[model samples]
Target: MTSRRLFLSTILAGLTVPALARAALSGAQQAAVDRVTDWMKGLKTLSATFVQIAPSGALTTGRLWIQRPGEMRMQYDPPANILLVTTDWRLVFYDGTTKQVNYIPVAQTPLGFLLARNPDFGDEVLIRDVEVTGGEIRITAFSKGNEDQGSVQLVFAEKPVELRRWTVFDPGGTKTVVTLSDVRTNQDIDQELFVWRDPQLFGYPDLD
Candidate 1:
């Protein structure tokens, strides 16, 4: 796979864990997880400008729009020529340069948990580690039986409990970090942003 495709699969496809034994959580860890879960459940909508550092150390900027229960759009800045959208049940990846489109189940992505109407961290996800430091909370997790696929570390600010960024580590140990800026939450986003129209058939429209 190309580096761009690799990064997308690592972030949105490889992290699915179908069935596995649950890991034990300490009292403090469980409390932290509860707080994170609550924050996720309350997040109805979000819009942000993001800076993504790929595994190759290449940097790209984009705008992100997300609505809960399963919808997201990531429109990369020009020269990157990539777009990713999550439909009701699938994650759609579009390669603007090649006009290629790919689809994968939404539940198979690490972001699925965040998009789930009721995010559950118990059986579907494994909490490998949790760190609280410098007024930040970081949760590192992966699929229980699918740890070889990769893991995602979600970073959040403490005082206000807002998501700031996430690092996705591929199987080879390379990591892609995406940091969010100018984040606005609980704001209305245009529903059209999440629509997945075939770029090849319908031609690409300005979804930005």
Candidate 2:
């Protein structure tokens, strides 16, 4: 089954940044966006684990691979049978149970719109507030009308913008927390891995 961690991690992790330091980040919200942007600007590729969790307690984990200027692929673990991939112009999902590979033009997805029109990390999703405690940067994003149209909280590492964790809360109160670990950037990735293929033909379309 999918680990529940990977699904939301990949999308929510892309929460844009906020306005210029009006005052300064005494805590997380201010520092995180700047730190993450600084770090990402120096790299070319990013890979990590992503997750999504349902309130019922199911979990899904996927390999989160990202290529700069907009490219990513998240392949869920066994049994869950779901894959979310971005091939520049498309954001595709293959559902095993449905035996259908559903794809939407990147222009249509809320997340896609964020990446396509604002990949620079500027103009954050809009920060509702920021607080610092102990050693974490805790930032809450704007309301539903914000960039990604969701409310979220991001926790930044003490060192910099390397996001340690984040949570996305939908209008209905459903929440997904994503924890990022073993982050590596500038690694070479094979181009073939991002392409979409038929699960029926591959026998494990879910894995493909």
Candidate 3:
């Protein structure tokens, strides 16, 4: 696949998963995941600037927004020509360069679980591995029923308890890492940000 395609796949991989390296979590590991999950569940809304590094070594920058109960938006920078939005179990990928949008079901992705009203790591979503090192906690997880799909690694900083980065491992075994900066949690993100409309209004081709 091309670099752009690989990168896009990685981004979408965030919500999808396959099999993972099975390991039981220790007391500390369980506590760490609990802490992170608590923080995430409490987040009413979040806005952040993100830097994404694709496995192919391609880099991209974007703005991100998330709300509870399955709502999210990723607006890529110019020349990237992509907008990813998820709402009500639907993930819409808009190709600004081509004026086409592809719709996906959020139920098929692990992300749907995270965006639920109560984000819990339960049957369908299982913890794979946990690592704590140098004030950082990394938790890896994969979807249970879809063990062959892929996995995601979420990195968090301790002490202040902040989410630092996330890495998505796609089915092709490509890792796409996204780092968050200038993060503002529980902010008043405008509802309109989640709306997906035709890009032609912004001077791109009409939606197909």
Candidate 4:
């Protein structure tokens, strides 16, 4: 059997098993994704904390704020003071010293779909699990073998359809956990909040 088929079957099979380590889904749960997606799609602003585990098992944490399908701001903690910002049309990187924001088109960024609610599930992501707990609905997506990507899990809440969290597991077993706590969903955020400017005007662009 080819590695691709083997990988695909493994994930699909897991979706039927009742293990946290494996994927699992229900008919009712399948419907849950639409609900969850709608909730995330409605959100105009969000805040979260993220913990990333690299391939070497080194862990890093950060605080993040995101607004709508476009804007986001993140500040990585300790040993890494990287502040990453983005808008619907561009990604901005803020370094400590020379403060010129690096920009990239949203269309060229894979994260665009990942951050958006109506994700293209057929291409790179497949719904594998859905569950509801307390007031939150959880949806898990495993990347199709062909996409050569990792698994991503998302959590949504009732009424207002607010998204609360997401988990990503890379093929190498590295993990990135994001929690959107103390979030305000559907808040009317100003468009100017997404715009970024050069930090050099302050003469201390890369201050730690």
Reference-based TM-score of each model: 0.89, 0.70, 0.88, 0.62
Model 4 residue-pair collision total: 5
The candidate scoring highest on lDDT is 1
Which has the greatest TM-score? 1
Q: Per-residue CA lDDT of candidate 4, range 1-208, in tens? A: 4322321222222111112334455677666766765555666676666665543455667766677666776666755545566865576666543333455554333345546545545444556667777878877765444344455666777565676666655555445555555665555544544556554553222312
CA-lDDT, candidates in order = 0.79, 0.58, 0.75, 0.54
Candidate 2, 1-208: lDDT as tens digits: 3433444333433333233322344555555566655655665676777665655566767677767656777777777777777885787777666666656665443344223434443243455567666777666654223343445676766665455666766545566666767787788877766776666686433322
List ranges where model 2 is wrong by over 4 Å. Answer: 1-32, 105-124, 142-149, 203-208
Q: Write the per-residue lDDT of candidate 3 for residues 104-185, one digit (tens) a residue.
A: 8876654566577777776667788899899998888777666556788888888667778888887778687889999888
Provide the lowest-lDDT 10-residue window in model 1. 14-23
Off by over 4 Å in 4: 1-25, 48-62, 77-79, 95-111, 114-124, 133-135, 142-147, 158-161, 190-192, 200-208
Error of model 1, residue 99, in angstroms: 1.0
The digit string of per-residue lDDT tens for model 1 on 1-208 reads: 6746764654674553233424467788777778888888899999999998876777989898889989998888888778889987798888877777778787777787788878878666777778878988888877767645767888988778889998887776778899999999998888888888775677656645
Candidate 3 TM-score, true structure as reference? 0.88
lDDT of 2: 0.58
TM-score, prediction 4? 0.62
Cα displacement (angstroms), candidate 2, residue 206, comes to: 13
Cand. 3 Cα-lDDT:
0.75
